[model samples]
Target: MSGTSGSYNAVTWLLDRNVDEGRGAKLAFTDTVSELTYGDLQRQTRCVANMLRRLGVRREERVAMIMLDTTDFPSVFLGAIRAGIVPVPLNTLLTTDQYAYVLADSRARVLFVSEALYPVVKDIVGRMPDLEHVVVSGNDAFGHKKLSDELAGENESFATVPTHAEEPAFWLYSSGSTGMPKGVRHLHSNLQATAETYGEQVLGIKESDVCLSAAKLFFAYGLGNALTFPMSVGASTVLNAERPTPARMYELLNRYNPTIFYGAPTLFASMLNDAATKNERAGTGLRVCTSAGEALPESVGNAWKARFGVDILDGVGSTELLHIFLSNAPGDIKYGCSGRPVPGYKVRLVNEAGEEVPDGEVGELLVEAPSAAEGYWNQRSKTRQTFQGHWTYTGDKYTRDADGRYTFCGRADDMFKVSGIWVSPFEVESALITHPAVLQAAVVPEADSEGLLKPKAFVVLRPDCNTDGLYESLKEHVKQKIGPWKYPRWIDVVDSLPMTATGKIQRFKLRDGAS
Candidate 1:
């Protein structure tokens, strides 16, 4: 592996070098309605690169992508890098205010938005002073530069601009659970390290595999696992431009026969609950399954395996680290634990005093990975507090067993006090999720009239389950599993719990709503 000081760009390396080796290699992109071959993909990307250069997109500038998972995303993503511009992929689902924050924060010079989303931001573009260009993908009301017109009659021999390995290549934003979203910057080498560690070691992707993931390309996990990993191994990928429902996902699997499926635990739970209806269409060529973004309950894991005949390997990753740092391998998976740290990454459990904790004790999980980001962009104080020495202090809390498996407790900030005793929301939430009636659960502290805080639970019930007396039943269930003190004083049954774009339960939302 080359050191970080060397000059290398991931997009140029993967496309140019790989094409020189064998231009006939296969890469497929199948959306809900369309598909493209590797040869078509390579030519389109080069054309887009040449067009962007002709449009005066300068080196070291920021180009924002607000499109969903489509063929154009990869083309424009690689095109930006090939033109020496940093690609900042923004979540299309974010509110206009959130989008404005990112555009202002990144100082994006151009925004490539899909037609469906163009109307949402059409009136707001003038507020973004630094934005110099707007490229709309589909034909609609916005009279912006059409991406198709730009690629018309363009040559496919655009030279990739050479970049230093340490130069900024991309920007991914945090979930903003604690505050406003922070931009986490990564170098080109970080992408390569992530592909080598998580892609090769954990995912075990091969050229023959067809990779499919429910996460969007804007997310770090999806970008690494779904797009970059498969590209690195010369495999095919399935991209759905719409929200991936269980029924729709099953249809895609039946149609495409993807070999590797990656998604969040929430998606897995929904699929497991609705498997019987989709079983007849479920005879796809899936060989491996993976879950991330949140902890996978043992019951969900077991149910998915029973239905799909393949284990759903659980892993934990963060935007700061680029991709999965801990994951269970194919044959070494455990039912109730997130597997040991992946290769090229180090994990440690630290106490409140910042000392190493014993194997059986719960503490903060700190990570040291070659793919970890340099720091939060332009936030020196936060960068200093979060990154200490060579390790990134992940806010997650966990317990390590003697066998080196890790059990997630909760976030360090999520832990709160009740009756002067520390409480872990995940412990109670996990116990609640095991109940047959509960599909999902989120626990948080709520204060009463006396100014004393107590545990409150927000639960999403399974289908055909009566909410009558169900809250009491769940309270008793938790009281019996953990101590009575851990029982929630108030329980609210709802249709769904608030979640971040990455599928993490937003406990702070519950706390705010309850107040």
Candidate 2:
């Protein structure tokens, strides 16, 4: 691996280089709906670059994508990067108002959208003063130029725009759990660094592997899972345009038989519950299964391995860090601990005073990696606060063992106090999910009648589970797993938990709705 200095464009390194290596004839991407070979992918991306260039898109100009997980999504994204245009992949599940805010903030000159999604943003596109063009795929219902039409007769030999290694290549919006989503700007070399360190060194991604991720291309995790890792190593990926329900996932697995499957804990829990209800094993040909975006409960891991005969390697990463820096490797997976930092990254558990803490003591995690984002796009104050010097201060809290494996201890804000004793919501939720009937659980501090804070759980029960007296049984189960003091004083069985677009539980919503 080379140092992060000198000129580099990720588009050239990931795509053009693979073509140069004579792997262009190999399959690159596939979904239930479509498939593209590496040669075809390169040609389509070059067409996208030509189309953008014909539309007067300039180097470093921001181009936003609001399309689903199709071959065109990666084509447009890499095409923008190849042409030195900053690609901003927006979440598909966000509200129209949120989309309007992101479009206004990014001041994107052009937006590439799908026909299905164009109607949602059509009324708002005219209101965006900086938006010069609306490029839609599949249909031209709004009189916008079709992406396919623009690509017709386009040459397949566009030269990738040369960019400095430090220049901004793309931007990803944060989950915005704390506030409005801030654009995290990543450099051209950042993708290569993560692919080399985590993808190559940790995941050992091979050209023969095929990947399918429940996390969409809009997220950093999904981008790495679906595009960066596979493209970097000349591997293939399966894309799904629709939401990855358990049923849909099973269908994809049976059809594609992906070597690697990436999903969040929420998805895993849903799959487990679904499998349990169906009373049949969901077969998959996965060589490895990964869990991230949130903590993976021990019980979920155990049950998944029992049902599917594959271990779920839980890890941790952030939008600012590009991809997973801490991961459980193939032969050394710890069911409950996030493994040591990747070879190219540095990790430290720091106290509130910003000093390193001793082993087994919970503290905020600070990570420094070559692939870390430069800073928030337009947030100077926040950039200074989060990305200080070389280290990026992740808001996640963790405790490291003597052997260096880090155990997640929930977010700094997610930890609350009960009777002057601090309680970690992740701990309580993990305990609750361990119960046989509970599929998913979220714990938040709810105020009692006397204004005292206590832990309250909102749980999703597996289908056909008896709810009568199950609440008391869960309380006792949690008490036995942890301790009496940490047990939820109140538990509410719910149909489902509030989740973010990327499948993380929105604990704040539960906290707000708690009586």
Candidate 3:
């Protein structure tokens, strides 16, 4: 029988494997305030498991983690998994109403919140009838018990529950194009699949490499980058609880000199646009960087490479798939395209009728990966629509080239026709971003005087950019670059564009004219 054949727990596979391999003394995690070696992590994780059991959270029951990225996060997340309890990591930046919605939807028995974020849901915790215990990492304020106090009494001798590899292990609320957040349920085996496929084969993560993810623990990309990938190889991770700003990111990179850095397109743009640090180089130890959540513009990728001498492997992934299934490798880098599918995954593009589209034609992307989520929790119709047989429908549009590289088009809902032809907003935005004055941009279709749909651009120009007649010049620049027909009919300067917490452009909100 295989190692995972009869019974398997991911916690044992991820955490214990490192200890069993004599890596217990090696550092596993480092945050601003403290560090956890592999041995300390194991002990703390076991303590967290015991603490959960003492609270009466049964096996297969859910525990919600509204946690920041810190040493506490790993113990809580992996501990719950070790005891056969599913841990749902909610977005820390979410509003109180959103927290209430997720708590009500998941019916979690326990909530482990960071002390900093406790007040957001302090009043609502008592209102959640399903929540039996509130454990805070820093304080016991507002009637919530301190997580440290609870774990202090618990001995680190709990046995890892024997759970099937296919059991639901965790949940993440997806930030989709147009809908309330939906809980995407992932199985235990899914984490290992991502680690083996993308983490091992694509990124070549090693035991000596240190990782810093600008994205937080609540994100699927960040979870794999900082936790599963590192633990799979017994590497250490640097966690930052606060937001990833340009200055702070630079400081971390200089201090830690991490081998790998995971970031998003927005961060890359901001880092490049900020003149003070735009020319700065991270430590020489930085070997590779990655970008996801949104398509990286070709200009931004080239600028970053020119400055840092490291390629940003632009990839596509979602909460449903757990981590990146399509990515650019180290040597086979492409500036403008989402690289070919990662090994062990199958990708297809189909038209509205679900027929496979030929190369160079736009279609919705569908993926079949080992890490695909089981389904959305308690949402049957949506589950049926997204997951069909072995294939999970990704709500993204793209066109595969003759050589098999996929170029991202706009989202399925965001695409609109202009002049009897479909226009990709990303394509136009990419063209606009290539200009010297344009710092950031978002494109959406708007009706013209003749009632014909045309492209409109909202741009955040560089600090020294003169907007006097700049729109006309930008239009001419775009016309000379992509094509005359695709240039923005109108360009409006804005301080900022609407964006989700994951750094994706909220084009739907821009379309609705919501600031």
Over 1-515, each residue of candidate 3 has an lDDT whose tens digit, in order, gives: 13457788999889998999999999999997899999999999999999999899999999999999999999999999999999999999888988999999999999999989998998799899899988888865457788888888799899899998988888989976666799999989999999999999999999999999999989999999999999999999999998898888988999999999999999998887777786566777999999999999999899889888898999999999999988889899888899999999999999999999999899999999999999998999999999999999998999999888999998998898887888999999999988888888999988887888899999998888777778789999989988889999888889999999999999988888822
Which is superior by TM-score, 1 or 2?
2
- The most accurate candidate by lDDT is 3
Candidate 1 residue spans exceeding 4 A from truth: 3-5, 23-25, 275-281, 418-421, 448-452, 466-469
Candidate 3: the clashing residue pairs are: none
lDDT of 1 by residue, 203-253 (tens): 888888888888989999899867788878677888988887888778778
Off by over 4 Å in 3: 1-4
Ranking of models by lDDT = 3, 2, 1
lDDT of 2 by residue, 140-229 (tens): 647987888878888888987878888999999898785678999998888999898989988889999999999999999999999999
The best candidate by TM-score is 3
After TM-score superposition, the amount by which residue 72's alpha carbon in candidate 3 deviates from its true location, in angstroms, is 0.3
RMSD of 3: 1.4
Which residue runs does candidate 2 get wrong by more than 4 Å? 1-4, 275-284
| lDDT of model 2, residue 478 | 92
* Model 1, global lDDT: 0.83
Error of 1 at 236 (Å): 0.3
